[model samples]
Target: MTNYGDLVGGDRVHASLYADESVFADELDRIFTRGWVFVGHDSEVAEAGQWVTRRIGREPVIMTRDRDGSVHVLANRCSHRGTALCWEHRGRATSFQCNYHAWTFGLDGSLRAVPYPAGFEKDRVSLGLDRPAQVDSYRGFVFANLDGSAGPLAAHLGRGGVDMIDRLCDLSPTGTIHLAPNWIGHQVHSNWKMWPESDNDGYHLNWVHASMVSSAPDTYYQETVLGGETGNQSLAVDWGDGHVELDFRPSYRRELAWLGVTRERVASYCDALVAARGAEAANRSLWDGPPHGLIFPNLFLGELNLAIIEPTSASTMVHWHTAVQLDGVDEAFNRRILRQSEAAMGPAAFIVPDDAATAERMQLAVDGVQPGWASAADPRGWIDMSRGLGRERTEPDGRKAALISDETTNRGFWRQYRTVMSR
Candidate 1:
C-alpha cells in the first residue's frame, strides 16, 4: 500500500510523485477510471452517426451519437481480439467494424454481426458493445465515468464549478457553444499534473509568460491578468470539489492591439448578446464573463479554448487545445476569439510551447535528493507547495478565493488529488 500521507504533505508533495512508475499506474486506476472525466463536447457529436474518439484516462474510448441521437462513450477496444475499432479522431459512420476480424458494432456499441456466426457454438447475439458506466452532459460539455455509482454531473460540479460553466455557455445568446475544428496537440515530456496546475495559476503569467506580455496582443484577457481591470473583477478563485477558475470578465474590445489586428471587429456582438439574452444577463456577463476554469481531474475550459490532459506515462503526457465557438456569436467575433487563442495556444504559438517546456523542464529537476546533498538519513525529497497556504478566504457565495498571485488553486488541486488517489 502507498502511504499517501508521505506523498502529499502540508502544501507540498514529494518529487517522486511525478516520476514513480507505480504512482502513475495507480493514478490511472484510482483517479481517472472512477472520476467523471471530460470526453468531448456534446456539440462534437450533435448529429446522428457523428463521433469522436479520445483517451478517457488511459483507456481509448469513442464518443458517438446513434441514429436516434443518443450519445454513448464506448470503450474503443473491440471485444474479440482487443483491437481498437475506431481510430479516427472523428467521423460520420453508420456503425463501427473491427477490421482485424470483421466484428461489427452499432453506434450504441451493440454488437450487430460477426463474420462467421456459425463459428461460435453459442449464440451470435451474445457479444455486444459496452458503454461506460455513466455518461452525461452539462450544457454542451460531455463527461463519462467508468464508475456506475458515481454522483451526477451537477453534484460533481457543485456551486462554483457549475457557475463557471454556466458563464461559459451563457456567452452565446442561444445558451450553447460548439467545438471549433482546428485543435492543437502537444506531447510534453513532463508529468500530467503540471499542465493542469498551470491552468488556474495567475502567479506565473508575468514571469513565465513574459514574452507573451511583450509580444502578444493586449486583449481583454491580458489586460485583466496584467492588473488593468478595475476592483476585484479579476481574481484567482477556488471552486469546490478540486475545481478552480481564473475568474475575470473580458474588457469590451472590437479590435485589440495584440495579434497586430487593428480592424474594427465584433463591434455589435455585445449588442446582439443584450438583444437575445436580455440586458440583465448581458450585463452580468460583461461583469462576470465566464472565467477560464479547470475542472477536477483533467478538463479545462477557457482561455477561449478547451484543453485536455492525457497521462501517457509518469514522465510524459499529451495536451490537447481546441478553440471553442459561441453558438450565437457572429463569425467576426469567433474569428477574433480564435485569433487571440491561436496567438498563444496554437501548436506553434508562443505561450503553449513555453508552458509545455516548463512542465518538462520541471520534471527534469526531480532528482529526489536531499536539500544539502546529505546522506540517506533524510533522502525523501519534497517539492514545497506552501505558497498562499494560510491566506485563503471564503466568499459569501461559498467559493474559496485568494490573491491573484496566490497558490490557493494549486493547493486545492493537490488536496483533491490526494483524497482521490488515496482511496
Candidate 2:
C-alpha cells in the first residue's frame, strides 16, 4: 500500500485515490471498518423494540432498543442462511425473524428461537443468530465495531472530538438532541470526501453560495457577520493522532434574526439554555451561527444538524441529513428550523446541489484515467488551515476574498485522509 501522507501535501492529491477500486476497498477496511462510525442518536430508538437499520462499511447493521431498554447493534444477516433480518429502514418489533428460515432473534440480538427445535441437535450452533463484535455509546450517539477487540470509542474519538460533541449537545436546554424529521437524502456521483472538503473551503461561500449571497441581506455575509463585524467566528484546525477538526466560528444571534428568528425568541432560547447550563455559561451555549463543523472521517454537524455521508462506491455516496432540536421545543419552532435548514443546507438547497454538480463533473474528468492529481494550491503552501492565505482581511470577521482558488479546508481534510489511509 502506498503512503498517501507522503504523497499528499497542501497543494496536490494523487488522483488514483479517488478513481481506483482497490484504494476504495482498502479505505473501507482500514478507516470505515475499524473506526467508531456514527450509527444514529439514542432518540431514534427511544422505545423497546424500536429499531433502525444501517450499513457500516460493507456490513449490514441493525440497531435496536431491546425490551430491557438497552441499545444493541448487530449484523442484520441471519446466521443460518445469511438472509437480511430487518427489511424495513425503521419500525417497532419484538424480534427479528428471518424470512428464509424461521430463526428469530431478540431486540438485543440474542438468539431467541428457531422454528424447528427438533431438527437441529443441542450442540449445533448453525441455527443461532450472530451478534456484532462490539456496541457502545457516548452522549446518546451509538456506534458498533465488527472487531470486538477494537479499542474504546472515546479513545478512538480523542479528547478534543468528544469535547466538541459535548458542546454541541450541551447547547440544548434539555440535554438531548432530537433529529429533525424533515430532511433530504441525495446520492452524489463522487467520493465521500468531496462533501466534507467542500464545507472546509471557506472561500467558496461568496461564490458557490452566490445565490444566498445575492439574495440574503449583505448583513449576513461571512465577513460582515463573523469576520469584521464581531470576529466571533474563527477557524481552527486541530490535527493529532489520526483524527482532525476544522472548527469554524458559529453564526451570531443577529444572523439568526435574518433567518426570521426574532431577537426576543433567540433571547428566550438563550435564557432556557442558561437555566440548564447556569447563568454564567448561557451566552456560550447558544451557538446561533453558521457553522459546518467536521469530525474527521464521515461525521459532519453543520448549521442545520447531523449530515452523514455513507460511501456506496468510489464514484457514489449516500448522504443523510438529520436535524437536531431540543426536547420541549414546540413543533412550530422545530419546523421553522427544519425549513430554514432545508432552504440553506439540504439537497435542494441553493448551495449544496451546485457542489454536488461540481463533484460529479470532477468524477467524470478522472474516471478510468490513471496517473491524475487534483491541485489544491493555496498561497499558504501545502496543508494550510489559515483563514486568509493570500487575500487581505477586509473585515474583523476574518473575511478574505471568497474565491474558488481557496482550498484551506480541503487541505485540512486531505491531511487527515492521508494520515488515516497511510496508517
Predicted candidate 2 versus true structure: per-residue lDDT over 1-423, tens digit per residue: 555664576567666676778878988887777666777788888899888888787678888887778998878998878999988888889888989877888776667787768876664444455555667888887877666655788776665557667767776678767776544577889977777777555555555667766676443445422343235454434333333333443434443433355546666676776778797565554433434556667777765477777888988987778777766556766777776667666568866787788778878866664422333343212223444445422334332222223454566567667766776
Find the candidate with the highest TM-score and give its number: 1
- The weakest ten consecutive residues by lDDT in model 1 span 250-259
Clashing pairs in 1: 217-258
Candidate 1 lDDT, 128-164, residue by residue in tens: 6666789998887788888666578788877866777
Error of 1 at 172 (Å): 0.2
C-alpha lDDT score of every prediction, in listed order:
0.76, 0.65
lDDT of 2: 0.65
Per-model TM against the reference: 0.91, 0.84
> Candidate 1 at residue 180, lDDT?
81
The 10-residue segment of model 2 with minimum total lDDT is 375-384
Model 1: residues with Cα > 4 Å off, grouped in runs? 123-126, 227-233, 249-267, 367-379
RMSD of 2: 5.2
